[model samples]
Target: MYIPKFLEKDDVIGVTAPSAGYTEQVDLTKLESAKFNLAEKGYKVIETDNVRKCEKGRSSTGRTRAEEFLSLMDDETVKYIVSASGGDFLMEMLEYLDYEKIKSNPKWIQGYSDNTGLIYPITTICDMATVYSGNIGDYGMSLWHEGVKNNLKLLEGRGIIQHEFDLFENEYVKKITGYEGYNLTDKVEYEYISTNKAENFSGRLLGGCLDVLIMLCGTKYDKTVEFVRKYREDGIIWYLESFDLSAARLQCALWQLKEAGWFEGAKGFLFGRPCFFMEEYETDFNEAVKTALDSLGLPIITGCDIGHRPPRMTMINGLRTKVKFDGKHLEMRYTELDGK
Candidate 1:
């Protein structure tokens, strides 16, 4: 794995819209605030033109999005890149991405949700580490959340110890001033399928939103099989989350991945909070996960602080992570694991 250079003072951070962009006043205001925040931190921030354009749930054509992203990759001044936001059309931009250029010019690119369509493939194909976390606009909030702060620290090449947050915003909130903070209400309690193993374990990090990953199956962008196999000795820790997938669909998706030999060398699993799981069939999240993955007998952790929810963890894809979970709370320390 090729771990790209981390961000430094005065480094230019490029923001590009690979899936969707902003058009509304609220969104534009958020973008402006984010830019100001970065600029105040002594870092230069630049955004692609499409980041302010939105139409029919898309920022621009797939090729155009890819072109903008590549432009940043080719720029020597831009040391890091961030996705503007998540949306539905990012998968279309995969075909137009130049993987060779990205591999040659490695930079830290980060995003979550729909951006997984791009981030996941970049790591698996390019053999370079990528970030699966919040977008650039997440910094727009007036008060920075803990998760967001830790994310910045990690990007700055600093070591960070990530612990479970006391609370998480369980439901969505409407932003009035466009600078609202998280109203954390729910007590965080990470669920475990079986604590039957040890209290701590380590593995090379992998996985992202299940909603986006399932679609990449059988596609040319999917190099997951090769990725896991290459790092089989270190063991694989799969951290997965979902955005609106139901219980039935979740289990089926897990089964599909299992059948596809995607988890060939996986040592454990990490599940994040699902956003809008209907569970109409009365199949709860626990039952769905146990039915498909419990047989593997590896440690399984659910209800984690990740995904389309507020106060999420910054997951460095392809980095070796030492995870400490006493069943209720979780802590993680990241390190470079034999990238050569």
Candidate 2:
């Protein structure tokens, strides 16, 4: 994994909706606010035509979004790219992307959820680093204060930095802000289920939404151990997260991965918040996860500040990193190919 140069102040950050069409359902005000936020940080925000189109309730058949993304990749001035939101259309745009062009000129591509489909394939084929962070819609509208700061740091090609881990402890209740009920606050308190201490471990960063990645298995995008060894000789670090999957389903996925030898040469594992919607299934979820890991005999860390939560952190796919674990503290440092 090669690290690209840091984005400069003059660099343009391209924004577009590749998966789902935003249309009217997208909050225009929030988009505008996000633009202002980026501008304030000394970036030139560029929004593609697909970002503004109202194609709500219709299928995402437009290639405009994919075309715009490819165009941005070729443009030297565009140093980074972010998604408007995650929807279920990126898989369709995979074949249309120019992988060679992206490989020659790698830039930061940030988003989560459905965007994982694109992120994984791009990283696998191009060997370029892309970010898995919050989308544009939640820019100024959401208060992921730590996430935003960390994202900017990463954009500068800085190493992974440790952050305080706080758990979401309360139930998120929907409130009536207008005639309809809305969740005014996005912050949720959580407990520290587990943490990876500050330590150094280097490998090509890989993996994404466990469910999505699993679904892609046997497809071109799947990064099976065999596929990974072809491009990456150092090893790989797997990161995963899920919204509200049952313990049984989660266990089945883990078993499949183990059987596939996904963990054969992995350095470690990072797990994001595994939020189970059913209150009664919390213990089941914990037990299933533990059972799966216990059988692997690999180092595992859970409850990272990523996925379906506020204050998200970005993981750059294909970037080699050194994670230092010091029992009470965790620190991540990067290394240059020249041994810097």
Candidate 3:
């Protein structure tokens, strides 16, 4: 794997809307605040022309978004690139993106949700690490949660020791309404369960939002097989989360991934809270997980505070990660292996 250089002080972060763009209908208070927060951190934040442009669920045309992304990656001054926001069909931009150019430049690209399409290709095809965290607009919140703060720290080249979140937002909020800042109203406790009482395990971190990951299964972008083959000895720890996939849908997706050889050498799996799920015929998240992946017998840890759920963890794809489930508390330490 090709790990890019850690970010430096005063480095430039180019924000491009490769998926969805901000528009007049959406409130700009948070976005403007996020920019201010980024500027206050002694870094320059640059938004491309289409960052704020919106039409038909995307900021602009796929070609235009791809061009902006390519230009930002090739720009020497811009050390990092983050998606403005996540939206539907970011896969469209894949056909227009210059993967060869990106492979040569190798800059850090970060985002989740719909941005999963870009993250997978950048890591597998281009062989570079990508950050899976909140979108750039999330930084607009005046009061940053510990999770968000940690995510920013990680993006700035600092290592993070992730433990557990005291509470997680059960519901999703599109436009933080009736609040001065981020309104994390509903509080739900975190429950981490391991299939086996495995105290410790290590592997290369991989995976993202299931909503988008499932869509890339059979496409040319599905490089999971090759990636797993190359890193089979090191092993792969998949940390997956759901955005809007139902329990039934999630089960099917998991089966599809299994058949596609996506989990050939997987050491373990970390599943986040489902954004939307149904207890179909007494089958829930756990049942779905068991029915689809029980045969593997790998340590399957669930109820992690990650994606779609508020107070998510920031994971670096292609980095070495150690997971510990000590009966009571679960913790993860992300690092780089010796000799790369």
Candidate 4:
């Protein structure tokens, strides 16, 4: 994997919208607050022209969004490029992007939710590292949680030691209410089930929102198999979360990935609390996971703090990592191994 340079203080951070554009639906106050917060941290925030534009479920025309993102990637002064927010149709911009150009000039770009479509291809195809964490609005939150702090530290080239979080925000806290900070009302709970014999392992980190990964399956953008094979020596540790997927849909997504050979050479699995899920008539989330993944026989840890939930941990794609869970406490250590 090709890791970009560690971001330094005074670096320029470019903000763009590759998915849904800004409109009355977006919270402008939170975006301004996030920009201010980022500037206060010693970095300049620059936004693309179309970030505020809205169209048919996209921030701008697919070509325009891709062009802005690629331009930022090629900008010498910009140390990082983060999406203004995640939306429903970022996948549409994939084809318009210049992957070869990106491969030649890899840079740090981070976001989650719909941004998964971008992160996965960048790492798997372009071979560059990307951060899967909060979006622009998240930084503007009134309270800076440990997860948010650690995310900044990681981007600054500092190592991170992640622990199971103490609290998480449930679905009741609607995302539309921005800048209030993460209202972690629910007690954090974790389930570390070692289906395999070993309880501890290490591998190259991969994965993103299940809702997005499922969409990339079988597309030309699907390079997961090749990526895993290239890094087969290092192995893969997949950490996935859902965004409003029902238990049945989650199980189906897992089954699709399994059929696509995504979990062929795996070491462990990390799951975040699903933003929204239902027991349905078939099974609950727990049963869906067990039934779908029991065949892999890997150490699977579920209900950790990650994805759409509040106080989520940041995971760097393509980073060599060490993970261990004792059915109670989960710990992770990230190391710079590729020397990029």
* Candidate with maximal lDDT: 1
Per-model RMSD to reference? 1.8, 4.3, 2.3, 2.0
Task: Answer with 1 or 2, whichever has the higher lDDT.
Answer: 1
Ranking by TM-score: 1, 4, 3, 2
Question: In candidate 3, where is summed lDDT lowest over 10 consecutive residues?
Answer: 176-185
Off by over 4 Å in 3: 25-27, 173-181, 185-194, 337-340
TM-scores of all predicted structures: 0.97, 0.83, 0.94, 0.95
Q: Model 1 residue 23 lDDT? A: 82
lDDT of 2 by residue, 84-176 (tens): 777655777777888888878878888887788888877776767777778876565444465666787777765656463444323455322
Could you say which candidate leads in TM-score? Answer: 1
> What's the CA error at residue 207 for candidate 3, in Å?
0.4
Instruction: Write down the lDDT of every candidate, Cα atoms only.
Output: 0.88, 0.66, 0.81, 0.86
User: CA lDDT of 173 in candidate 2?
Assistant: 53
- Sorting all predicted structures by lDDT, with the top scorer first, yields 1, 4, 3, 2
Give the local distance difference test score of model 4.
Answer: 0.86
* Model 2 poorest ten-residue lDDT run: 175-184
**Candidate 2 — which residues are off by over 4 angstroms?**
24-26, 54-59, 141-144, 167-202, 230-233, 275-283, 326-329, 336-340
**Native-to-model Cα distance after best TM-score fit, residue 280 in candidate 1, in Å:** 3.9
